[model samples]
Target: MKLNSIISERWSPVAFSKKVPDDDTIQLLFRAASRAPSSFNAQPWKFIYGIKDVDTMYGYLFDLINDSNQKWVKTAPMLALGIVETVPPGRTSLNRFAWYDTGMSVGNLLAQATDMGLYVHQMGGYDHEKARKVLNLSNVHEPAAMIAIGYKGDPDQLPREIAERENKRQGRKSVSEFVTKNPF
Candidate 1:
């Protein structure tokens, strides 16, 4: 079976080139993300981005990342935090679909980035509490993931152990393992 090239070629990489995406490309990436469907169109996804070496926001985001991810993520020309508003606007109840919708938004972002010859590495390793404090996020806004964005770069630039892991083909389980017509 054949998959779309954009889906097949997309991957998370530890190495990223020094090139920085210009303003238009940055806007387009988020525009694609904004297009993602959401329950009741709450559109709770919000992104905070920082261009490396261009602003203090980058340093603030970098400081939130754990040491393990910082080693390689630092090379990326841009960084971003994916945030979700847990409660739908003007409602006190939790929006159960908030996280799921946020993931779809990021999925749109990944596809758009891949089609544009850029790459994105979504990371869950971050200081969640610190992110809230540093970004001055409101109680409703929750940081979901930190993202590294840039062109794919030389794996040799990564740590020896990580470099060895970088090129390995990641495998997915067969349909039989997870899919079934019967209700669980």
Candidate 2:
């Protein structure tokens, strides 16, 4: 897909078909993530996908979700937890760049999903501490975020609150408000 098309056409999808991603498809998504840029190549990301135990994953997230998000996420088939090691590097502080790098991977993954005709919804409205316990996750690979992926579906079937959001056209902040000509 062209850069502009991908940027403009892609949107987070909350309504997913019940179809779960096969191992090969999930691996392809991970492979796309692997190509994402990382700080100094420390490459701190480690991902965990929930397929067979999707219920557990959903329960885990359902418990952790920021109340605002739970209403919509009730239906996705696959959930990917983004993790990153935060140990300090030589003479430097903790790997602050881990999440940043992982976020890049998420961008790549989402874009790839878009290319593959799948849909993804990236979320931060989740409880990190509980996520650690349910997934047997550790602070080592800090659970930065979770993403839901699956086939797109009719938004009307979603919970009313999220269904409203799904119908609205997504937009970005004005470049004029965010871009700069030089160092601030």
Candidate 3:
């Protein structure tokens, strides 16, 4: 699909089908992320997926997500925790752009999912420490956020409070609001 079309259609999907996504689908999602560009090719982003019932420890990370997310998240058959490792490959130092790299990878993942008739909701209201234990992750892989994926489901499945918020039209700041022609 065209980049503009993809961007226009991409929204944080709050409801997802109960059916779990297939392995091939998951592979493609990560593959898209793998292609994201990074500073010095450091390739600092890493993803740990907890597929279906296979994630016996899912509850650890699952519980960390905000209560607001719990309603719809329970219906999603797949939850992905996207993380970023320490900046740079050789040095134990920080690179300010590592988070940017990870964010781009997530954008790739979301677009790929959308291309496959799937939906993704990126959320930051989660507990990173709990995710670390559930996924058995090391410090090198820090939890950046969680993404719930699947096909879109009935809007009725959401609570009235949530449903109301979901139905509201979303708005964005015009390019004029943030774009500037002059140097600071």
Candidate 4:
């Protein structure tokens, strides 16, 4: 079976164009994410975003990213931090699925981006503790990932090794390799 073009074509590229998506477009991305299902409809995901040359938060988010990622991320036009609300409002117990739910939301965001001819790269190599301190993340909130968003850029502009890596096709495990029948 063939996969949908959007899904098949989706990839995380380190080389991003300088073009900045408009405010409406950015908001639309979040709207798509908002449509994702969540535990008890708690909608635990929260995103903090900033556009390059337009918002100071962009720099702060960029600074939080590790040096290696920073090299190519600098070309992206926007950056965002994905955060999850660990506890539901008025509740003390932990929401075990908060992280998973947040990831679902981000998945929706990525699909929307691909449909709109944009690219998104989610990064785990960021200063998590510093992010908590700098962003003033509350006790109930925890950082999940940092995202770089923009159009695809010229690979030639990236460092040689990174450019090569960016040009490589993304590979995934076959369904049969990970799937199992009931009563396994």
Please write out the lDDT profile of model 1 over residues 84-173, one tens digit for every residue.
999977899999999999999999999999999999999999999999999999999999999999998998988898888678878999
Query: Candidate 4's residue-wise lDDT over 57-112, tens digit each?
Result: 99999999999999889899999999999999999999999999999999999999
Candidate 3 residues lying further than 4 Å off, grouped into runs, are 1-3, 133-136
Q: Clashes per prediction?
A: 0, 0, 0, 0
Which pairs clash in model 1?
none
Off by over 4 Å in 4: 182-184
The candidate, 2 or 3, that scores higher on TM-score is 3
TM-score of 3: 0.89
Question: How many collisions between residues are there in candidate 3?
Answer: 0
Location of the lowest summed lDDT over 10 successive residues in candidate 4: 163-172
Cα lDDT tens digits, model 3, 85-148, are 8656567778778888999999899889888888888788887777777678766677897988
The true-structure Cα RMSD of candidate 3 reads 2.2
Worst 10 residues of 1 by lDDT: 161-170
Q: Which tens-of-lDDT digit does each residue in 1-184 have in candidate 2?
A: 4457766778887787777888788888999989988888887787776653545555655567777776767677787778877864343468878878888988888878888888888888888887788778654657887787888988887877777777777777987889999887
* Local distance difference test, each candidate: 0.94, 0.77, 0.80, 0.94
With a 3 Å backbone cut-off (N, CA, C), the pairs that clash in candidate 2 are: none
In the order shown, the candidates' Cα RMSDs to the true structure are 1.0, 2.7, 2.2, 1.1
